[model samples]
Target: MTGMKDVEVVVAHSGRATLRVGDVFLKVDGDPANADIEVQAIGLAPVPTPTVLWREDPVLAIAAVPGRALGALGEPSTASPAAWAAAGAAIRTLHDAPLPPWPGPDLSDIRSKLDRECEWLLANAVLPADVIRLNRDIADAALRPYAPAFIHGDLQIAHVFVEHDEVVGIIDWSGASRGDAMFDVATVTLGHEEHLDDLLVGYGEGADREVIRAWWSLRSLNISRWLIEHGFDPNVRGCEFDVLRARAQER
Candidate 1:
């Protein structure tokens, strides 16, 4: 019931192809051999606007309906409770999956991204003299923990799928790697609070939510910096930087 021509892929930001396949709908490029041909289709919603690229020969492709993406169910809590619950269960299931051999970019890698931004900001005089160390400290903390797992690098509400009140599939394994599971948790919590609560309900109280929160907050600082230094045109991240500065002052 799906047509290939109708299956238009669009990327809002520029990035390398995570996966590409002509005959199949889902293909992961990192570990090309690890991909599953049996999987019917894969769906992914643009996080920050991916620059969708087409391929004549897909590394991996599957039969699929080019619907609005898996995670576009609605606002976090608006979807059926059962759907949220199923999504949670599926996420836990991913966590339980054996850690893949592939190593993803780590906190140190994140540090590099932050460092590059900081360097640019400093050179441009956007970063105040007093705020450099504070930003450095936050980046250091994020790069401290040596944790790893098969993480969806950009785990967000827009990247999951549900049907019949059950999670039928997961999309956007582009950033998938053996890295910090907490990073994925932070990704969910920092951006989607309501859905995060619902997901926690299913995940139970096994992992310390506070740890995830800390990671989320710290990552937020990092993300804001990245956008301010690189993405935003008029320096919108400057406002976020101000907020973080104020928060730091209060503490």
Candidate 2:
């Protein structure tokens, strides 16, 4: 064969699956509108994003960006503190950019989801009722009103890439929307709370610490079941379950 590369499944579930082949990444999304948003968001974001190679109905092809991910969810980051700061700076730039034309989920939607997830966690015995209750209380802080900004709704640590203390790229733009900028920060800093200080160095002022912590709980609650059903484990030592338990200890 002139050229052949082994295909790797980066992630997969019912709604979406991402595959990597050589330097190209193909994402298959159930909803075409999400693909539309990713394309538009990359164009609008001030920070570096994957280069869209092509798109067909349910699949989007993008050129791979350079550098390694900032970190994994359940592990320590090898990326330098300065790299985290650079990511924070990049996020700030994105938040300052003009909002995407598409509308994002509103507060009511989030509130309803929270209520629904809490019920499920209890019904399924996902965790201790007390632990869930404590976290649900902490998660309250994030439900309040905040000025919206362009945000990467799923800015998990692995989504940001860095090399030599500089943020070279951020991937997975399907979740980008108009939302709380702090939510983006908290999402990126989840599991690795120690780097929050360094991240804030570049993020600048007006980022509330309390709200960020609250987001940790809220986000853990929101995604735990989805991760489980998608064949991912959120119960590992430093993952989402730990994030929830850590909050309980603080109370």
Estimated TM-score per prediction? 0.61, 0.98
Off by over 4 Å in 2: none
Clash count, predicted structure 1: 18
Ten residues in a row with the worst lDDT in model 2?
Answer: 99-108
- Local distance difference test scores for all models: 0.51, 0.92
Rate residue 218 of model 2 by lDDT: 94
For model 1, residues 44-69, the per-residue Cα lDDT tens digits are: 22122222233233354444323233
TM-score result, candidate 1: 0.61
Give the C-alpha miss distance for residue 188 in model 2, angstroms: 0.3
